[model samples]
Target chain A: AQTVTQSQPEMSVQEAETVTLSCTYDTSESDYYLFWYKQPPSRQMILVIRQEAYKQQNATENRFSVNFQKAAKSFSLKISDSQLGDAAMYFCAYRSAVRYQGGSEKLVFGKGMKLTVNP
Target chain B: AAGVIQSPRHLIKEKRETATLKCYPIPRHDTVYWYQQGPGQDPQFLISFYEKMQSDKGSIPDRFSAQQFSDYHSELNMSSLELGDSALYFCASTQGWGRANEQFFGPGTRLTVL
Candidate 1:
């Protein structure tokens, strides 16, 4: 079974400072997808960024970027100029490229890293 | 943009009772997935459906059953609920079956089994 690991259980970042949340996964499949999702106090889960395993280039979405190291099986999320709104529980999820059992390409998520923005 | 919708944002139920949760997928979407998130825990995949058919399953309990309707809507029926069943149940939808499609998640229904 594939598993995602997030070593940091809690992290604090100064407002306007930069922060990185680390993630690692165990998978033998060559083709897959990695994603970072943010769950705010409202409990709504929002997609932050995504990276394709086949792509060598890292994925960036405005202030959110990912450092994807395929060989190391590491996918880290970097938030530049972190804002108070960035304070949330962030999750790293893994998705397989192929659909198993007709449509079970569900995401495998890590335990999550709680990010606190200090003003 | 419109997003997935789940009914009964909060539900309180007694142990061994039955509860049903409904999900309305986004227009034109053909796939729906169910997930359970315990307190302070990551969401766990429960099951998935494609075109109103059971496509895959995960750690769903035998007491819980779900199905996707022809209209792309879905429902999770929980019978003989236990206290451990209390959690936030989320419904996500995606277009098509394969490929790296981004899933749109619903606000989720919070179930409190007493």
Candidate 2:
């Protein structure tokens, strides 16, 4: 069984500043994927960024990027130049590279952390 | 690019009532996934379909069943619903079972049980 952990229940950052949300996971598999998802008040789940375990290089999407430490089993999201629109519930998720009984892999998510960007 | 579409963005049902939620995946997407998120909680995987076949199951309750259609659309049927079933239902899709393909999510359906 795999599990994701987001220790921070809530975090706040001033607009135009930077904030890093920490996440850790427990998985025996060496190959996997890590992801960050954002859910706004509209209740819509949006993919923020993804990091492949095989790729040591971090993944970045504009202001959103991930610091993936495979050996440490840590994947954290860093938001630079934060904006008010970034205020949302952020989730750290994990997916196995290996299939399950011929079934597709499903995402294992963390409890989630609320990110508040203050203007 | 068109994103996943979930119909009846908001639904209100009473206890023990039956509810059906629909999901239309992005064009050419062969995989569909369903997840449930309770108030102030993270989304939990319920089920998944690949090529219109059940590929995976998660924490879904026995009262809930889902299937993918020939058109790659999926429907989740919930029966004997409980107040606890009231939550946001999300539908996500991916093109293939690739190692790095990310699941694109829909706006989700908010089901409220009264």
Candidate 3:
């Protein structure tokens, strides 16, 4: 069994500033994938970024990036130059790399952190 | 690029009533996944299909049933609905069974039980 943990329930940052949301997971599998997703007021789940456990290089997508510490079981999201539109509930998710029963693995998600960007 | 499609963006059903949700995966995607999101809670995996066959099961209730058709579209049938079942139902799709492929999520169907 695998579980993702987001310790901080909520966080706020001033516009144009940067903020980091922390996440950790428990998994015995060596090969797995981690992701960060954002849910806005519309309730749409949007993928922010993803990282593979086998890759040491962090994943970056424009202003969004991940600091993946595999040995520490930590994967955190860094939002640089935050904007009002970035205010949303962010979730950290995990998935195993091994295919089970001929199907792709299911995602295990954290409780989510509410991010508020104050103007 | 085409994205995953889910119909009846909003549904209102009474307790003990039944509802059916539909999902149309992006063209060429062979896998479909279903998830449930409660109010102010993280999404939980319910079930998944691969190539029209049941692949994985999660916390889905026995009163609920789902299947993927030959066309790659999937339907989730819920019976004896309860207040707890009134949540956002999301359908996600992926092109293959690869380990690193990102799952594209649908807009999700919001089912409200009264």
Two-chain complex of model 3, DockQ on C-alpha atoms against the true structure? 0.65
**B-chain TM-score of model 3:** 0.98
lDDT of 2 by residue, A25-117 (tens): 998887888999998888888889989888999999999998999999999999999999999999999998854323248999999999999
Q: Over 4 Å off in model 2, which ranges?
A: A99-104
Give the clash count for each candidate: 0, 0, 0
Candidate 1 — which residues are off by over 4 angstroms?
A: A99-103
Pick by DockQ: 2 or 3, better one = 3
Give the chain A TM-score for each candidate: 0.95, 0.95, 0.95
Q: Considering DockQ, where higher is better, how would the candidates rank from best to worst?
A: 1, 3, 2
For residue A40, model 1's alpha carbon misses the true position, in angstroms, by 0.2
User: Once superposed on the true structure, which residue ranges of model 3 sit more than 4 Å away at CA?
Assistant: A99-104
DockQ for all models:
0.73, 0.63, 0.65
Q: Which ten residues in a row have the lowest lDDT in candidate 1 chain A?
A: A95-104
lDDT of 3 by residue, B1-114 (tens): 899999989999999999999999999999999999999999999999989998889999999999999999999999999999989999999977754688999999999999
lDDT assessment of candidate 2: 0.92
